[model samples]
Target: MAHTITGRKRLLARVRRIQGQASALEKALTDGTECAALLQQIAAIRGATNGLMAEVLDGHLREHVGAEGLSAGERERELDQIAAVLRSYLK
Candidate 1:
């Protein structure tokens, strides 16, 4: 429930789509689908996963770090920290 308030529906929709892509990938593997087709599925899943991550991260920033009274420098530092963590996580 990363998005408890606004955009929850949109986030859930993305998650549902990602789940569908994952299920499709599993089915393709079980069916011994062609290599190229499997690769395409994998790519789509990866893109969807990345999109979901970006959405969650955006929500986190807006909710946790984007407080009403934070100074500009503090916000920038927080954003930098978040970006660093994301880079490490992706790596």
Candidate 2:
């Protein structure tokens, strides 16, 4: 199993919610729903997805990057990789 299997499951759940959100948006559009409301829904889904990604990343950091048994240099390298990921995510 992957290191973050639990986290991946949680992320998948969030994504499923987003899928529902998208379906609702689609239905609303088909029914001629207001553009503003659709946009709001899109923004909400985006926020939720970003939050999910953050959770997954945090789990990964705690597991591999910050594993308690790692050597000092290995930990430093992993942390550096994590920092890069954080920077990319921020962008």
Candidate 3:
């Protein structure tokens, strides 16, 4: 919660940038932009979204999981599960 509060502005900025990207994507589609350009916009949005996910995941790991006194093996297993979920989600 403290991390979220402190990072609120930065996170909101990222979200607003993503929203702008979405708007641009919509405009491009409406204006019949070229396929290559449209694909590039989509890739940009995906990259930004992935970045945001990584930021949140990092904070979660540090503040929640990392603070816990889990054994090395347990931590590794937990992280592996998280990675699996992230992979499935991205797919």
Best candidate, lDDT-wise? 1
- Each model's TM-score? 0.75, 0.71, 0.78
lDDT of 1 by residue, 19-66 (tens): 999999999999999999999999998999889888888778887678
Ranking by lDDT: 1, 3, 2
What's the lDDT for all of these models?
0.87, 0.83, 0.87
Model 3 C-alpha lDDT per residue in residues 9-58, reported as the tens digit of each score = 99899989999999999999999999999999999999998888888778
For 1-91, candidate 2 gives per-residue lDDT tens digits of 2556756677778889989998998998999999899999889888987888777777787788767899999998988988897898789
Q: Please name the candidate that would achieve the greatest TM-score relative to the true structure.
A: 3
Model 1 regions lying over 4 Å from their true place: 1-4, 71-85
In the order shown, what is each candidate's alpha-carbon RMSD? 2.9, 2.6, 2.7
Regions of model 3 farther than 4 Å from truth? 69-88
Error of 1 at 21 (Å): 0.4
**Better model by lDDT: candidate 2 vs candidate 3:** 3
Minimum summed lDDT over a 10-residue window in model 1 is located at 1-10
Cα lDDT of candidate 1 equals 0.87
